[model samples]
Target: MTAETSEPPAFLPGLELSRILYEEGVRPVLDAAHPGLAYAAARVGSGSEVLGFDTARSADHEWGPRLNLFLADADAAALGPAIRELLAERLPKHVRGWPTHFRSDAGNELDPVSGHMTATDGPVDHRVSVDGIGSWLRRQVGSPTAELGPLDWLAVPQQRLLEATAGAVFHDGPGTLTAARARLARYPDEVWRHLLACQWQRISQEEAFVGRCAEVGDDLGSAVVAARLVRDLMRLCLLIDRGYAPYGKWLGTAFARLPVAGRLTPVLRGALAATTYPDRESRLCEAYETVAALQNATGLTEPVDPSCRPYHSRPFRVLHADRFARALAATVTESALRDRPLTGSVDQWVDNTDHLTSSRLEVPE
Candidate 1:
């Protein structure tokens, strides 16, 4: 293509880019080189696009026409490298005008995943990956398959789980990829109840702190506590809907898509925007009551009163969040999870990037 025709492709969502690359570029190469190969192809994991919140700005780094290609254990071991090299030799300079290559000769092989898509005439250093589905699963969720136990769920991060399950799955020729995504889509009911309880327990641990901090003339600390509660409440709404919450970067974006965001957003914003402790308390209590009522509506357990009252003569209003915590915890019947403390999942207690993003990063019991 001429320089005039070679300007960077206008931004398409990364998932769409993956689709175009597969259909237009990768498929023919695979069909001719290894026909009848049993495999699954998808754009799952890592990128903001996987979670459907990527924008043009996302094109700036680690974004491109790329996807995961899964094969059976035998097929992956025997043919994976061949297929990867074959794509590099035959895939086009661009898939829908976005270069199919993610690395250049000048590129540092040790440079980490910059995801910088660049045009190339030599054998294209394309980003299509070919792997055994089991290996991929182990990297994504610390397992070889999607069947995770309760303790396993607690050890995995929601962000990792979201990445594993949220993105578009484009093909199911091997049949397991679709099933894997479905299995990991949400937690089991008992685990759900346990997590909901822990989330409420998180709020309870802090609801009184908001006012207490302000009373001690630490308005900043009060706001900080209020903000944490707001986040917990948002994540709680995600759990109530049986959806996985993304990490902090996209937490609000994911939360906004939830059914409760319309009612809760205003209250949450009011709490954050409040200038005084009384206003913060008033707005936060409204949020607590709203979410408390939502929990009751789920019928997860016997209804706890959703109204706000003073924090046991401490002059701060609260929903007595532990009541909701206890109520939800009562419904869990899974013996492994039953009577567990309020630690919730790894995401509930751990937010380190290195820890959260690692598949084998086990959390302490």
Candidate 2:
């Protein structure tokens, strides 16, 4: 049997698969076995559903009928393992033709019985993990609680935050998980401005380099700079739209959802694809002006003219992004935030997955 639907036999999206598991496989058992047990159920973390980018191919591993059930700390400790054991015997063998038990690897060998995906009646290490919300948050992000400070916000990876808050919650018994997610929906207004300022600062630092490199006959270097500018510009758009920018895999996908994406997508693509130095420069200048116009429309700061001018003492035409950065910084009322270095958030500067995912990251004071 396959996980086919009336619509088609195509791979089920992670969200749909998760919902089926919750409604058909988990909910009924919980109601019968542990009725009135307060818990939260959701499908989040590292799945395409969390990012809403899953395809049929995503079902190959770590996919299918999986969920997280968050209970009180004590209740979880006492009942979590038993619930897992019960669900292992009770859940349907194939949820929409997808196995509830994932195959596991043991000691350099694929154990069919212990595989991450296996049939029921076997020793099933299920994916329906049970834990307290605090433990869950602590594992997903550093802070177990939601009262995150500026440093905490800066240190937590945007991708992780996005995952933590993105997917659908099937149930929240005490509303704890929902409230925590609300707190992380976005940065505070002041922090948003600070990040925006730093993003602009980044663009300003490098906008001139694109032309400087080209002038030195380093067309390759010029192209590289242009690509970086395009990335920063896309990120800036996300900030302006008050959206969290995911990592590279979904950067473009997330960017496309922004209101400005339709106008800026072609320009950004042209900037990256341009081969000649002059062509690259021209495309980048256009992109910069477009984003500058977007910045002005927000009215977050004193509107600067959305046009390119020649870099001082140089023939290169460029957008003076520092002007925008300074304008945004001026709107920040917090002296402490304004005084901090404009390095932006962790995702802004760090690219390594291991570093971003580490909860022990130290945020600069």
Candidate 3:
């Protein structure tokens, strides 16, 4: 039998579909097949659902009825293939009218099996991935756990780190995978403070250029600098909130959820929408004060003044963000981390997804 529906079906969220597949399909079959197989199941890695941003538009490809079933290395080596084959035969053809098999041809067009839905006969190229946890972690992030040092945390992109920890786990029988996830959830405290300091340093480096560019009669350049500062400020807020900032597509979405977003959004928006340099500078100053207050509230460092001031010797009005940087850096007790330059994490310095996504990313010593 084939898998198809009468008409275009309403959108189903990936997380819900994954849970249903695990409870109704995979769990029963696993119980009957091996009786006591130990495995973990989750819907995670590189999807909007993992990030809680999936929508109807995300249903096209690489979506629907998909999950990761992680087994211990030995269990995976022995029963992986048999379980995969068994699921192809026993699993339901459709979960909430979406196909169990996700078929993509040369042009990447998704074609679900086109006829009747059946339990025993359907396409065999199922979306469920069966693997060992170690292999999965190595595949997802370069390391199996967050035993990462300062440089290791810097090298891995925040997007990758976010993906490594974002989604929901349906079940973890042995709990190894769950434990691994907890370890990978966030950077160590020292690393977080180091990155936070570096982020403020980034703002300090460019905060003066907004007015300097305007002084040179470069309104466009001034606006550009202001926009850059706005992004840095948003990211800094995310860091203060102890949240991972996703890439550009979801950056605003994620930022909106921050505690300070309500007060800061308008100021940031004004900074970006300002055409004149004075207007831009004024709006950015407002943003600076707001974020500085957020920093003070965190009590991460002794509160620095949340007001903008002149960049010394230059006529530019700015926050002199290095003050905040220095305050945060002072709290870092790790000698190695304290001595390192303030480059922050991969996402802070690099905007290109291609470079950030590379597994071989080099961390500066």
Candidate 4:
């Protein structure tokens, strides 16, 4: 899903109500009839509602009475019919104030059950599987072999990925969700190291280009660089701190709520608003030191002073030039990018990142 079909409803309101239905309306049925079928948990994963960041404006269609049911494949297959029958007969006509806009067929589109239904919504909106940890692990981190390919990491929008990937898991039985969570909970240690290395390289590469952009008589473009610098800085913070950067809409919301938000916010804004290349350079250097301090306090990584100094030279700054070359060659995954070598194009870099984080598509791979 590119930027177009990425609108997800918030999670709490919908999740709370769905949990109620699962425990009271649905769980009892599973306990009585499908006792042999294990009950792991029910959760709401994708959508804005799950992220606790949706506004009232988010309530449109396909935004109410949804729940995900996870069971072993055999259990799901064996008890699928019974569960659906129970949902049809006993599942409340509506949850809280919202109608169970249950669509007739799991495959129904558009007017998809505005209310309630089984987890497996056939082609789209299928309840996720929690039968085992491996399956859930693949879904969470988005391994290519696990139904969805590696999220185009480079192309999918960040906000949508955050919304879909950051929701709550509500309930669980087998702890399959728990194990999978530990893996996808954050980037693996090696992956984080690689990304941090890449990000640092990126800033180094552009350090020399600040003047070039300024020379083009585009203060706006220079400002854009500053903004990008701020973004990367924050992303590094999240990574170093072991948090996934949420979608754009909820970035400030998410960032402000972090423990370091108070400290980092002012620095981030300062970098973004810096007017001159030298000023930006100084601000970023400060940002790096601040990040290093935080990393030390948290024991996230071993401290190492950056070899590159603040940009002070004008023509073909050696450090800046070297860092740029390194950043260009440090890509972790190609899923998000359209072209193999990004060529220092900001638009392409952002575009590819967005694509890589999008939700799994409906059409078969």
Candidate 5:
């Protein structure tokens, strides 16, 4: 009989599809032909599922009934084809109401996935596995001999990195899956420290420049600074937990749940909502101080500036300013608590038009 014989239910929640496949499709193959076929796992890696943001519309092709099969090289070579053929023969051609042969509705002419799979429009966009334990480690963190360089912190898009590293590993044999998961669990302490440091440095460099931005008649530029502050601050919280920050859409959701979340939310919301350039600058500076205090409280870094000095100054002032800003962001738990020390200086917030050109950072069209 053709695999298309039975019509299936509507798309199960992405989380449920794996079990549905295992009990029906994958296990049957092992029961019949390859007793040593070894293992199957439903790792919803990459894209929305990994980030826990998947919705109903994500149930298009490349989205559901996905599985990654792992075996000893010999078993894989033997069982892979058998599993495929069996699935082709016995698995329902449609899961839920979705078609197994669904194609791209994406307007562009991108190539569709080349395997037989049903759709749920979920966030899992790919399925894969390493040959064994060693390969899994290398894939997760790079080999010692051919180590992956530390990411170019500034250039990496937060969402892509989140997807690359997100998701759960469903199964493993001989500890290969466990080992890969341990390695993927979190960034090393130093790496998190460095990224947090770099992000804060970026924010501090722009913090007091809001008034200058508005002086050039670009209130929007000032708002961009506020937005970046929010992004970097959210990144800081993720660093505190040793987690990589996901894309911005989920950034706030993640932030609101942090242990220090209660205090941070108001400060962040106030900073984001401040309409006047001066008010925004004050709130931002206060936010920096609050974070600095939290850093000190947490023992994350050495004390630099208890005062939270203005950003406009010479080498020493700039140096201390960046130092405290970095320390606070990495260690602070409650954002509002850290921002208690609001600044009194307004002069540093003003901008000169000469430095406000729109073309210095422009790229070719």
Candidate 6:
């Protein structure tokens, strides 16, 4: 992003740019310096491009030709530094018209290591990260072993899980990255059901509040409750399809790709846009039934009527979503997870970035 060049190269998607970097810039260096060196190369962690949703504007920072180069534990310790040094001496000044050299994105901030693109004549400080797959996975999901327990799955954030699984793997010479990705691709059956039940439990707790707030003449409170339910419903749809919901910045972008988004989007928007209580209740009820039917179609549990009924002793219409929650919970066969509380995972109850990013997150018993 340095002005040393007239301007940065016209934007190419980040994943594709990373692929070109490996093939043209990094591969030739490896092929010559350490022939037959076994490694796995990929663009699999922490970037908008990894998720295939990055736009032209993403080029501003933390967006360029970058990828993870994974090696065996022993090789990583023995040769990682040498490989990095070799790339620095040999990689082209430019690849596909973007600078191979990089510098810190922060103009005045600390952390001096270069992390963004800029033109340079000196040995280009590059971003070809080197480490073992196990170490990388351990840093990512807290468990180094391939076999992740139920508690392990609960501890890792959904966003991190998405980062580990979404991006393309250009090579797997170590013969383990693909398997590792597949293993982390989705939650186990029992855990998924538990998540579904907990999502429904969330809705059951609040679906009546949209109407009750308006009943008490708190239009603002009613609108706020309606928006919260809309968000929960969207997250539930994501769970139903087995997609990991990204952080709030990209939740709707991810949800828009779901099969149910076509019909569900309008009902959800209607609920969010409603000013009066009647319109909010009507749209919310429509959404409730739509999602309920979608859940029933999965055949995960006994089908509950997807109809809206009055909240007991009040005129507010509700889905009594606990019917879905209890039915799904009944189908859980995993003894460790059965009869557990409705909290699904760390991300379910907590949204703190510091906690979500930590690899040492403790799972509650």
Winner by TM-score: 6
TM-scores of all predicted structures: 0.95, 0.93, 0.91, 0.67, 0.67, 0.96
Give the clash count for each candidate. Answer: 0, 9, 1, 36, 11, 1
Candidate 1 achieves a global lDDT of 0.86
Candidate with more favorable, higher lDDT: 2 or 4: 2
Please tell me which model should have the higher TM-score, number 1 or number 4: 1
Candidate 4 per-residue lDDT, tens place, 1-365, comes to: 11224443333465666576677666776677766565556554556667766655545544555666766666666666656655665555544544453334445686555433323222223232233334443444344223232332322233433443455665667666545444344544434444455555566555555557877777778778767666766765676676766645555776777778788788777778888766665666666667656544644344344434635655422234234324333434444332333332222245444443445422212
What local lDDT does model 3 show for residue 352? Answer: 93
Instruction: Please state the error at residue 35 of candidate 4 in Å.
Output: 2.4
In order, candidate lDDTs are 0.86, 0.82, 0.81, 0.52, 0.51, 0.87
235-301 in candidate 6: lDDT tens per residue?
9999999889887878899999998899999999999998889999999999999999999999998
Shift of residue 228 alpha carbon in model 4, Å: 1.3
Better of 2 and 6 by TM-score: 6
> What lDDT tens digits, residue by residue, belong to model 1 across residues 160-181?
9999888888888978989888
Residue 173, model 5: Cα distance from true site in angstroms: 2.0
Give candidate 4's whole-model lDDT.
Answer: 0.52
lDDT by residue for model 2 over 45-153, one digit each (tens)? 7767678898876665676778989998888899988998998878787788677777566564544333345455565567898988887787767777766777777
Per-residue CA lDDT of model 3 for 1-365, tens digit only, reads: 13333453677778888999899988998998888888999987777888888898776567778888999877788888888999888888778777786554545335553222222355446778899877767666666544566677777788887877888898999988888778878778999899989999999999999998999899999888888898888888888888888888889999999888888899999999998888888999889998889889988887799899888988878999999999999999987788888887778777997776555646565
Q: Give each prediction's root-mean-square deviation over alpha carbons.
A: 2.2, 3.1, 3.3, 8.3, 10.3, 1.8
For candidate 6, the per-residue lDDT at 290 reads 97
Model 4's TM-score against the true structure: 0.67
